[model samples]
Target: MPDVEGHPTREEMDLRTVLNALADPLRYGVVSALLREAEGTARTCASFNLPVSKSTLTHHFRVLREAGLVRQVDRGNNRAATLRTEDLDACFPGLLDLLRANP
Candidate 1:
């Protein structure tokens, strides 16, 4: 079986965790990129143009995953990340709009 990571269910996500994840400028940029992407789009971690090093990038992704704002799937040697847009919208109406506006 292919290795897979876990994500928090909508109910598992809370405002505090999500807010903490977005508090970082780099992670917020990740959210911004996802917002501009086509619906349900997922991108590889290396695709992000952030100036952070490899370790830092991994840390950022983990924070986002733990916060339930992003989902990462392992595909062979690469991992793809996607925004949990629908889930977030369902849980907190207009939250994505707020992120986009205030980001």
Candidate 2:
């Protein structure tokens, strides 16, 4: 996530959370997009976001949060999401990097 040299230590998140979150294709796509740059990336829940319904997008976010692949926080009137790269790395070394960097 944050590549800052002195970034504050983070709390270790649950592994099952991360795995279960990414189990779905939609959530996987969201995670992929978020990790493509930075966390806390915000996007609309239109079909253009992905080949899914707005309600499905909400479900995907909920699954991702419960599973731990990404962290969702309320920002203003919107909810922002970010991939838990550090927690994922800790749970499965190099797995996130490999997945993120995949061709």
Candidate 3:
């Protein structure tokens, strides 16, 4: 199946893109929190409690989505995000484990 709007397909996900998205501290924190959740759990962007403006947060999500590290969908007035853990694991084995180990 195709991915959500603005997200790359699993086969299209690139290691460089994923790494670059996680390179940002804010985005990394978002992913880290999502990683801690049960698989397939979805959290609204605001739930992350990021200390950035709405526009900035939106940009962060966009980066993650485009990198194929996240899957986001509009939920009423909020956008909810779930980490693409399965996809990430399929594309790059041990990547999530590395992130978990380092953080």
* Candidates' C-alpha lDDT: 0.88, 0.62, 0.91
Measured by lDDT, the strongest candidate is 3
What is the full ranking by TM-score, best candidate first? 3, 1, 2
**lDDT tens readout by residue for model 3, 1-103:** 3454888988899899899999999999998888889999999999999999999999999999999999999999998999988889999999999988776
Q: Is candidate 2 or candidate 3 better by TM-score?
A: 3
**Candidate 3: count of backbone clashes, pairs at least 3 residues apart or interchain:** 0
Best by TM-score: 3
TM-score of each: 0.91, 0.67, 0.94
Q: Candidate 1 on 41-65: residue-level lDDT in tens?
A: 9999989888989889999999998
Better of 1 and 3 by lDDT: 3
RMSD (Å) of each candidate, 1 decimal: 3.1, 6.7, 1.7
Which residue runs of candidate 1 sit more than 4 Å off their true CA positions? 1-4
Q: Identify the superior model by TM-score, candidate 1 or candidate 2.
A: 1
